[model samples]
Target: MRTDFWKKTAAFGLQDDAVNILSNAADYKSQVLEQIAKAEQRIIITALYLEDDDAGREILAALHQASLTKPNLKITILVDYHRARRGRIGESKSEGNAKLYCEYNEKYNSNVKVFGVPIKAREIFGVLHLKGLVFDDILLYTGASINDVYVQQHDRYRLDRYFVLNQKGICDSIESFMNEIMLVSAATPRIDSRPIADYSEIKLAHKQLMRTLKKTKYKEPRASNKNQLSARMFLGFGRRGNDLNKLIKNLFDQTKEELVLYTPYFNFPAPLMRSLRKLLKHGKKVTIVVGDKTANDFYISPEKPFNTIGGLPYLYETILQKFLKSHNKYLEQGLLKVYIWKDNDNSFHLKGVCSDSKRHLLSGHNLNPRAWSLDIENGILLDDPNKTLEQRIEAEKVQILKHCIQINNYDELETMSDYPAPVQKILGKIKRVKGDIILKRFI
Candidate 1:
């Protein structure tokens, strides 16, 4: 099949509607609750991680309460099966959020359903990392998972982007994609079945899901008269049959002016990096907004005195430093711009990129080896040249920038050693350890 065929099929007509961009967890909670209260038909959610943390429980409680009042309100939650079974770094056994969610459905609420999809075996190179919520004809997309930090349950927060749109065509197409491609696939099993955690079963289900994904055809759904917005969805997998990769290539190849990207991690696949260099060499304006080492991370190992489970911050900072060192001339010439996020006590976890201020991409796909090789990711493409989506993007950019301390010159970077005293000491100790390969996976 030709690549353009899929691209054309995905690029359907849309109508104009008001777009709302939410900046933090507090805003997200308000918006989600508001939508749930008004929902008349159904609520569809997809998340990478859904822990049984305070925030997660609160959301579940709210949903349950809403269902009690509005018995007809149907809710479906799709999360990663593998994540559901595995415990966090310091936790023992699963808190059983998935199981609890299932029980809630079976016992008290007849209108709610939860499903888990294991993506590691399903897409050997990727895992399911998309986060979205669809209610009636409205869609909410974000890069946050269900946790206290993600929703600002206590004092801490996780930096992310939240967007709302009421485009009927886009909403309907995404809903269909969830139902036809995800719900029907073997990778996704009904939570009520009490699926076992066997490697063989996971592998089998993965193969089945891949087969279905390969054969599935996605076309832009016909727009209803009430529709008001134009959007497109893109996936990133498969080798020769992967239309998502082609779509990304086309976006870069066809860009005439500028590209702006927002990703928590800074590492890029070889081809993507080459494409970025090519764009820079061609004098195109490129702005990359990434999370600073400390702010972009997830866990800070309190046990090890400043060690972190995820090496996101270190990896991203190293990549940025290397890129700047290699492309010093480009930096001086104003062809490249890099911004880092550093909220007071928050962590940054949003992902996706926008190109030419006309195209927008949103997903949970962090730009790192873990995301590329072990997580499934999904994002949407929107051509918004009229600045319709600028409000949300700009607001997030500004808020994130507020927490960052800029490193504009190589001289500044060389002298920048203002890490927390404890972190600085920890970094020094880590550099002394020679055989610390085990730390790479978790860090």
Candidate 2:
């Protein structure tokens, strides 16, 4: 009854469900391939970017092979158009993932269709940031795109959270959102066969589609008495009528006792920072698990050649150090706990928030200015009214914390002076030009 109050008051939308959290990227990839291989009806995947790497090629190959055998099986993948047409940052310019898509389509006879969804005209401003992979009646949700590092196809990996749901209602809802909103709109069909030399050529078409998608909302199915779990889907774009931004703040507002959060990036929106301070002022338990500088994807050690983006890890560390110093009182009182996740040379990219044992938000939302303002982001808010997912949630938290070390004080963080020469120099230049603020939203 108390939970129902927020559902009504804040206008939170929900659906009935059942879910299981995967431990790592390797497990996630295995489960995805297994599900796709066995799927009878349809398989739909939506992500930010499906890189043209070994893991990406392997997954694509499997889908292509399955399509040839099944004949009638529907396999579709939706990735960011701009991302597919461009090379990795600092890499030599080339045709990018689009070229690979063309080769794959030609080789497979176009059985597996990969559509490109452009949320904005270019990659910098915005792109399709949706996250989910649906195989028939099952949904595997994650922040990772199909890539070697993301899927852990090699020794190096980018750590991310994976969740699987096997409920018909939720699965159907996600499928419809892809079919009706994404596919039917401005999604570029047969992208594999096209030669996209420049995004500007299709800029107008993409803008129109972006407008249409912003007005669209996924109609969540009503929860019934027999349903085992309650969850809400939050989707946002552009700023107006952004349900996700409101819901995240509301979750923070509704926290009674303790709040735990996981984010790969240290940049928090001003409002969220204020909310965190409020939680501390009220003496509530707050735990934040973020990636250490070494675990940051942008981190380049002193041994490696420096890129401008390499300074981001140090910048984030600077932000974290500032926050910890400001909240030293809470840290001493044990009201605040900060853990930096680092598993040797592996990277970290986990993102979500949990308020007590009742409210769990499973999402790709980075909870930063960029996620709040630019990208098209979505999430599932699981309200465990009956505490049905308590054990699973605790287990997931334990696995994530396994390789992390708690920060006892602000002094423990690395200072700018201690950073590598390249990083320190780039950071100095960024500060001089006030480019750090500009980079915050894009990175």
Candidate 3:
């Protein structure tokens, strides 16, 4: 086979191929359900949160039905142990949904198993933040978790990117990694085996997890495809020790022309921020697309006074404004472009990056301090020699840009007064907020 053919095929270990980008949650749901309907042998899912909402229940129902029909099918789901047991920031605590899921697992599908990997103690400093679905040899990866808003069951929606790859080698490698870290680890305990309220048991579990992570080794198997995908997996506090940090550095150093970044928050690590600054100084084109203040948050009314829900958005705007002020020169020139998403209501939650229009990366890691220190993040990288892939990426950029308000010129940025009255009012409120928003780096 030709090198280009091998590169594209090596990622999914498949001959025929079709890559679809689901721009909206409804599209995402339709695609996912279609995939689920076709799955035969095995289905594995790992996500940050799997709520007990309409979308969540619908997915569960589908899985249950699949298991009933396919007697030989095997299904496994892994969700964050911490988030699964607790309530959302402003929501009431209820285990009713979890109980329902358990009942479904036991009564409906004996072939399907659900596991919750609690990282509270093991990830005391961060969060377990990996999201992907594997059906047979195909992998669908994105930053979205299982929830109503993320899948757009209701009117609310989350902005995200989705990639479907049929590379056998890549899929196998990732599947093996998941099995080793989450399924076969010495600390792999049943989600409902015992209550984690016991302090001594929690401590012991943490110790076991730490020990397993320290001893685990994730090696990249060698493949000989000239067009092989350039992808790497990153862990916050697991088998990989700062491997992600090194990989990121290598990617930045290899950039040639343009760099496109998508992050929900603007709080970048010192090293990454400094590296971006250096890239700008070298005259490279950098475009950052982020969720506008009101759009880039996760909060409900009952948690604060006046039932206001803009904490996350406000925090992001404040940091972004500061970063821009510090790099005014870059803004004055044509080196940097900042775009923020705006809708009548709702927040945005997506994270990924594209560099030089040749390299693309999709990950759950936000460009914030917490992602660096707290969340368990993973991504796939594609370095296409065939310019076709680059063209496709550029098209994606155009589509995303349509949903954003651009800030490429310093003069344009300074004219905040000229912005729509609502946007100006939001910015003003963020400026007056009291202390910095603080949380566990990974959560």
Candidate 4:
């Protein structure tokens, strides 16, 4: 049934020679810059945020220059509306990245367009988490947003997967979805304007836009060519009808030999966790790669004062310990394997799933409760029945695991009691009030 569904679904023909999986952030940044510089027809970039840092400025400047270099070039950037309008999380509210957009607009009389997409009326409930970049005929897909660390523009970096495919159909489909659906919707407004539209003004449109994005799939695609993999695009929204979430579980159930899953956070939604437990019970090899507490983006160094958010990594660790304790039998039997990824001061932000060395899901979906029910998400699933890309995928995994260490014991991770004084205080308070249970749903 799953095989029939995939075949019947409209998909793009992805030739082997046209696909390139990047290894590191630096190369991914370079590719973005180069593609922007030379783009002839169009460029569309979508992410949660496009920070106001050195790397962000550099990329924005490149886009402006590209517009000038080619009068016919059309460039568009879309980010979370609420996120783009607010300052740093803890800072007093003020005009945030949108201020920079306005300044750039006036300075260069910019031809490039920047749109703030409000996926929800409130940022707390949900935000636009979609991620993809299309430059002309090439599509660069990743989970990393534009920032100094994400692009490795500085000494510190946030690691994530990068997959580039030179497919015109895929690029066009993404581009059109933005232009026809997102741009036309009043909920998504041009942030480069003198004054941004107030949420009160677009309240009605916001509701309608959310309904459209949640239900719409990309345009139908051309069929796969001979000896090429079949690629399907999935728009993941609400829990009840989320095809991506359903497909992810199906991928787990269909794993004949082994299942490889990667998520920086260990907080899997209940459905995925159930599927994972079933895999272990059935004697299938289940391998999971997660980041150490220190590798969490919310982690604060010992030298720094701990904030409430800093306790999140410890919270994640506590969850990991609980899971490990329950599955110690699987660990002993060698059916379950867990790898902790840690690299210096850098953080890990990779998310995807691969089954039996045949099916691969390349996506930004975090595979958590928030991603399952809150944010707007999307993914590209590549079905390689002939295992054409197996060797390449294995090589990529090898490079990723170099900085990772496998752990067999739950005792290896830090317990809540082992956390710092400030972290312990806050986490203890949350646990006492049962806030921790509510907290896991959003984080």
Best by lDDT: 4
lDDT by residue for model 3 (360-407), tens: 667787866666655566666665544446555667667667778877
Q: After superposition, how far is residue 414 of candidate 4 from its true place, in Å?
A: 1.2
lDDT tens per residue, model 1, 1-443: 24233347445444555467787788888888888888887788888766777788778777777778888887878887767666666567874566667665656655676777876553334556766888888888898887888888899888788888776666677678888788876667766335544546557767778667655544465542222234677665544555555556566655678877777777765556777888898898777777766675554643554444443355446557778888777778888777767666578877776766767776676654455435555677665758676676777778767876655654444212554455445545665773233333222
In candidate 1, stretches whose alpha carbon ends up further than 4 angstroms from where it belongs are 1-7, 10-14, 122-125, 192-203, 215-217, 223-229, 299-312, 369-374, 410-443
Off by over 4 Å in 3: 1-18, 122-124, 192-202, 214-219, 228-240, 299-310, 408-443
lDDT digits (tens) for residues 81-187 of candidate 4: 99999997667978999998898888877589999998778998898988899999999999999999999999998999999988898888998798899999988
Which ten residues in a row are the worst by lDDT in model 1? Answer: 434-443
Against the true structure, whose TM-score is highest? 4
RMSD of 2: 2.5
lDDT, each prediction = 0.67, 0.82, 0.65, 0.88
Q: Rank by TM-score, descending?
A: 4, 2, 1, 3
For every candidate structure, what is the RMSD over all alpha carbons to the true structure, in angstroms? 4.2, 2.5, 5.3, 1.3
RMSD of 4: 1.3
